[model samples]
Target chain A: MSNHELPRTEETRVKRLPEKQVFDRAALNALLDDAIVGHVAIVRDGKPLVLPVGIGRDGDTLLIHGSTGSGLFREIADGRPLTIAVTLLEGLVYARSAFESSMHYRSAVIQGSATLVEGEDKLTALGILTNHMMPGRWEEVRDTTKKELAATMVLRVPLDVVSVKISDKPVDEFEDDGDDRAIWAGILPLRTVAGAPIPSAMTPEGTPVSPSVIAQTIKLA
Target chain B: MSNHELPRTEETRVKRLPEKQVFDRAALNALLDDAIVGHVAIVRDGKPLVLPVGIGRDGDTLLIHGSTGSGLFREIADGRPLTIAVTLLEGLVYARSAFESSMHYRSAVIQGSATLVEGEDKLTALGILTNHMMPGRWEEVRDTTKKELAATMVLRVPLDVVSVKISDKPVDEFEDDGDDRAIWAGILPLRTVAGAPIPSAMTPEGTPVSPSVIAQTIKLA
Candidate 1:
């Protein structure tokens, strides 16, 4: 289901190509749910630092976890302003002109400070994050101990002040431009394919790939 | 050709898991060359702002182009310090425990200020960027005019201060942890596949798909 449209602030407005801006919260959520990783940005000293992070969507909030001793975790614990962006490149748009050529993609950018999750809520958030990365496997794995929870930092950033940009249209040629009819112009679709599972050598022989992993691959494909 | 190794600075040092750090310049270049999109971050109004950008590599530097009207372009034109990260998710690591589950990915982060290219360099940079995205399509398309170059902003960020992290190994279990022979632990490899090209409806009938597009699809697959 669809949630209410995301409330846009001055920071979330699409200043370029306003036509590509998407407002439906459901659309925003769909992008988040489909994506497995996001690029998180935070300013350290004066330079901007961007890192690719494993991400999970918990309803209206986004969950991210890391080692508490890591600098990123320490920065998140500070509750400073940060930006998390999830981008999925769908295809390569081949236009008649180099200037018009582009990619078909859906991107969501969330701007806010993340709150450190604690106690039982932290455990639940971690599980949600794990499940998001590898669906259905969470229940099969062993439970997280108190020490593990203590060493990990889980932060949740609400889905507020967000902007979504989607570019899916085919190449739009300029009427004034002259181009040869013999030249082919089109879209080359790009998809993430899940290859065969390679069981670790340490595992017992004859262990088959689980259905959940297969299902996840199918969904991504 | 392999360039000299990337000299790490206080900013680019991998503080968390030092084992995953990569210093080879060729390795860094390969990641940038293989990636089609990257997440770029720049500080605006004392807040971190990250966006997805189409990226290309020019020898030792990275090239990114956008509309001059875009705020991100303007910020890059201002010669401000920013970060660009290219991440390729290779696989999903499944471990016996939730805490140990992780992703196999290769990510490169470059921190520097972009210099706006002009005159002959501008056109060259644009061609390089376009060719990187769509290999053989540049020569087939109409030539870009002086007006088009003026309206677009092309920035070059040097790969001087860079950090690369790669996680490719399979799950490494803790020695003290008990094993469950029935549990599956392994790696699910992930790769981007290029599907059949869909020619634009406007394209003339009977036109064959170009060799460049076919080559690109094969490379990605």
Candidate 2:
């Protein structure tokens, strides 16, 4: 579904970017889907807190898991307003002048209130989150006990309020400042590359690398 | 040599981390000195904004560069509270339960008003910022023009309040869990690896790759 079709509220600002911005949702999703970790920002009693945490996406809803006791997750529920953004800076931007310098980034921001998914929804959400983190992991690993589920909190942020902003360009100066004398200015692409995956030491020696891990290499590429 | 020494100020919760936190003039300076980029968090009209910007360390002062026309930097020296934090996530903390999973991060949070610098300080700060991003190219690039400086803003955040919170354990849990399931859990280890550096086409032919690029391979290591 297109971004507009997702549930969006008035506070959603349709920020602008250069014309070169990408329009492909698949590419955007691929970037978000491949990573298992993200940085979450929230305001706690008037103070801003940013934490890196594990995250998962189930279709359109993003599942963020926290300790049942986390102050950040506890502060949300029902329909409180909040903002969660996940950004992967794909490349470094270099401009002749610092003013024009910008990053080639793919960032998805969700502005909405998250609600607790309970009962069967909670079970399914847990399954999805585990699978999102590792392919075949949910199936091979021990299932969560009832007590574990009761002690965990998962915040589900709907996808409709999400938007992606990107910027990528070669340096173009209004006039030549003779920077060719010493400086080399241009875009340098950056990307995450998977090295040899380390299996859990306790894992059986005969277990082959899962299909999910193999797929991510090309997915991020 | 700890974070406490950076010329900076304490947050309302200066007691949170305690001596485990650093708050010396030199501690803050060292933390800033070892790093090249700083994450500048500014409050614009009561909203918190975090941007990864170029920064330089000068004795006890931290320097950040931006455009004068940029509303964020323009408001920095206006006696508004701008929280400048520079952090490097050194390690990941894997816990038996996701709730206990945390990161070993070293961050410096300084609150204060910034003032514009002049004379040699400006030139020196600009030079450090330029070299911070790409080391060898600074001497090759033409110098900043007058109009550029007139349009640039540099805010100095003193290193007065800072600390390092770090956890590197594979899985910290209750004794029973650690003795049993903890054996099943271990860190996958996170590292950023630089792939083959693609040279810019503008680079003169036959110029081999520089050591600066070679050194980046282990940045995430």
* Top model number, TM-score: 1
Error of 2 at A181 (Å): 5.9
lDDT, model 2, position B52: 45
Q: What TM-score does model 1 score on chain A?
A: 0.96
Once fitted onto the true fold, the runs of candidate 1 whose alpha carbons sit more than 4 angstroms away are: none
Clashing pairs in 1: none
List per-prediction Cα lDDT, in the order shown: 0.88, 0.56
TM values, all candidates: 0.97, 0.74
The 10 consecutive residues of candidate 1 chain A with the worst lDDT sum are A173-182
| DockQ of candidate model 2 | 0.24
Looking at candidate 2 chain A, the ten consecutive residues that score lowest on lDDT are A6-15
Residues B1-221 of candidate 2: C-alpha lDDT, one tens digit per residue:
33333333334233332434544455455556545555455443344445445577765667777777666577666756555555544433433443343445555665555788776677777776665554544454556778877777776776544444333444445543333442233343443444454445455565555544444334433
Instruction: Please provide, for model 2 over A1-221, each residue's C-alpha lDDT reduced to its tens digit, 9 standing for 90 to 100.
Output: 54524333444443334254444556557656865655555454454444445678887677887777665567765445655556665554455555455456666656566889888898788767766664434554445677888888888887665555565555555447563523444565666554454544443465555554454444445
iRMS (Å) per candidate: 1.1, 4.7
